[model samples]
Target: MKRVWGSFFLAMSEAIVPLERIHSLIVVLRGQRVILDRDLADLYGVTTKRLNEQVKRNRRKFPEDFMLQLTGEEKDKVVANCDHLRNLRFSPVSPYAFTEHGTVQAANVLNSDAACDMSVQVVRAFVALRHMMINHKALSVKLAELDARIGMHDEQIGEIVKTIRQLAAPEGPRHRRKIGFHPGNR
Candidate 1:
């Protein structure tokens, strides 16, 4: 029983790391969210070479939309922007970038218990990130609408202030009413 419990705790701890690490691995390439092959390998507890081998074996499963090999320029850009990828800067081969679906497919091809477990967390992280982006976009739209409304009100407010100032100002010297009755006027 103790051994079983120990393994369960160990698995849980291992699973916890994937959720956190996978989120950090996610990057934007060509405006699409993707994870690099090296990063995915690290997450799956495999070597880059092994991971690439599996991907190569299952080439038909990964369509263009699912996976793409980063160009030299793109690879350089990734290395430049991401400090964690500094080691990859000297790598002989440019890394293959996998979209959300591709990452899932890789997990299926790897066919290891760890890969399957981590894949679930990876997918969860992607979904969470997507939801956050959607919410941010909606909030931005609402803010823009509020800004437009405020701009319209600014002109109206200025006009109201001008009218109030005009009403409050003394137009000219006020004519005094006669204290006594004026015979001519009567």
Candidate 2:
């Protein structure tokens, strides 16, 4: 029995999503990286309608933060941005966007071996993106620090140059012109 279940799971997990494909499916919306329901359903080996039905049945599992219904404008933008999502442009119902947590919850709600395996892939994809963002953030911070240091040095150097120029100047008694017309012998 164990061997049979193990083999079944292995077979189900055979259809793996390429890491790049998964990464492409993740989009930033409302300041959160999320996968659209259609894309996620395709990855999980289910119809979009079926996936939505499950989400509706287990409504409590998905909160506003985890899943969101896209606005018409946002939907239009998504469709325009992704060539593969052109079909969605004609879809009357706006698609749902699932965050990382929502993806895991969806897998659980789906209760299938494929969903389980694919959820892991989804999580890994999100994590890989997060790591990249962190690396970029660190690099930016380092650049800002270097720029500040250079700017401080530049200011100091300018002051030093000004002082040197002042010190190198020749001091002489100044001949001043009288401000008002000086009346001599009239």
Candidate 3:
């Protein structure tokens, strides 16, 4: 059993892909992060038509959040926005976009060695993205705190400069008026 598990892990490792490659394939649509059907198909080592057919057959497995069909307008907008997806403009049917859950479900429907291996990789990619986002939020908070500290120092420096300027200015001589002297002796 240990050997079996080890081999299983080895297979999964063999399928592991670079985070950058998977990250590039991810796109945000309607505020949801998703991977296009064509891209998923490529990862699964199957034709796009075959993959869509499987999804249609296992429609019950996919909920709204799992898989969503792009509307004509949305599809057009995606095509316009992404130069790499330009071919979609000519296709009659817009490709389905699969969220993280949907992507894993797709692998189950595919039920192939390559599908299973790549599915694990896909999940890892999504997790990595989430981790990075969390780190970014923490960094943003730290930067905001540093900015506030610097602002406070600036105010202190400004007050010090004002005091220095006042001390440096020469004091003019005081002129005292004679109270009882009104002599016009030129």
Candidate 4:
């Protein structure tokens, strides 16, 4: 059961981002390492401003942890890291911040049944992906250990082969064995 889950986890990690994008209806709503308002809007098929408006309207649903505005420095960093954001035309003066749940909350605020369903599915996929990443990291560590052991075994095997070759080599002069012929009797 554990192994099955681990395998499923690994597969999910490899697949999450790609699958999320394919669903198109479900956006990542986050940046490389952080969730930004613009991303949420893009995923929810709303303007960035509209997304913020919905959050503002339902302020109680989102505390600081659930949603916040991105700091200038964070926004700048995001722009720096993201090629799409590098262009001035698409870049916003400010961006909002939200956790995964914030986006889910946005779905509710929008009151769209489709968005709600997509959000739930996306969240589940993300969770599975996270599990897979953890499993992959563990497997990578194990693989490193196995590689080291295999390298050591290869060296040991080489030494053994060398030793066997030395033993097989004729070290001393070979004496011919004399066999008496029974030709006369025959």
Candidate 5:
């Protein structure tokens, strides 16, 4: 029984989330890309009810900026964008949505040593993910600049080839030709 429980705990711990998912998670949260409570619960490996309970239990920690209940319009927009959500005929009455900032704040709100530790790890992962995104954006801009320069060089080469072709062609009408142009003879 102890072994089984330990294995369960280990599995839950392993499911916390990898760093790569943090960026997408932030986008879903802050970008108003709505992920339902049920979906979030699955991702976090917690029951939806339990997740809501946790949030309710620490309501004071979550400011309006950190978390907000989704408005009807927002929910409708989400449903429209997601084919999977088409079956959701009604908006969730009390579904709480956490923004990226809110999720970070949540780490501090939960009243447990484990929660605190997990929050710290999650926050660090978020920071690393944010840095990676910024770096990727910078690299993309640099690559675009390089591409533009290469295009310009290609145009210049084409122009040089055209000029060379023109110079090599016979200088006049078909019957006309230049004669005896030599270095030593005027």
Candidate 6:
């Protein structure tokens, strides 16, 4: 029975936030990929208010790179992009956007078993996202190179086609005097 209960708990915790779900929660804000305070709080099984309170108490731990409060425009963009965050569209306060490091720090400050576990998952998700971005950048570079090469080849092919067409065209008529008889000489 102990083994059965342990397995059941494991299943439940694994379902808390799948990697794909965490990926969807990430967004680019202010040129940095971040997760919002509410999303992190949900993953950590805490209220956003509680998370913010804890963060405020440990304010020294978080730095500019770790976290930042969104501006009104930034908040509006987030609300527009994420349907679930529509509630923030009218809120007087702007939500915090946490960087990868801030996320781990938040988990440490919270001191919850679930928060600690979710922190690891969040890191993994962030790492995966970074790798994917790098791969996409490489692919973009390769595509640009291919397009440049094709452009050069197009010019060469056009010259070849023009030359072929000139060669295939028939020559103009040629006139020659009679070899043996000429009326003027007679």
Which candidate comes out best when scored by TM-score?
A: 6
Q: Tell me the tens digit of each residue's lDDT in model 4 across 30-76.
A: 44223566655555555667777888888999886667665667667
Point out the worst 10-residue segment of candidate 1 by lDDT. 1-10
Put down candidate 6 lDDT per residue, 134-158, tens digits, no spaces: 9999999999999999999999999
Candidate 2: tens digits of C-alpha lDDT, residues 32-131: 9999999888888788888999999999999999999999999999998999898999999999999999999999999999899889999999999999
Q: Candidate 5 lDDT (Cα, whole model)?
A: 0.60
lDDT of 4 at 184: 64
Q: How accurate locally is residue 171 in candidate 1, as Cα lDDT from 0 to 100?
A: 85
Residue pairs with backbone overlap in model 6: none
Cα lDDT tens digits, model 5, 73-103, are 7667666665655755474464567655665
Clashes of each: 0, 0, 0, 1, 0, 0
Better of 2 and 6 by lDDT: 2
Quote the positional error of residue 113 for candidate 5 in Å: 3.9
* TM-score, one value per model: 0.83, 0.75, 0.81, 0.61, 0.63, 0.86
Q: Give the lowest summed-lDDT range of ten residues in model 2.
A: 1-10
Per-residue error for 51 in candidate 4, Å, reads 1.1
User: How much is the lDDT of residue 39 in candidate 6?
Assistant: 87
Checking candidate 1 for backbone clashes, the offending pairs are: none
lDDT of each: 0.86, 0.90, 0.85, 0.62, 0.60, 0.89
Q: Which ten residues in a row have the lowest lDDT in candidate 4?
A: 1-10
RMSD of each: 5.9, 8.7, 7.3, 12.1, 7.3, 5.3
Residues 1-186 of candidate 3 have per-residue lDDT tens digits of 121221223353265556677788888888888999988887776788989999999999999999999999999988887777889899999899999999999999999988888988898888888899899999999999999999999999999999999999888987867677588933
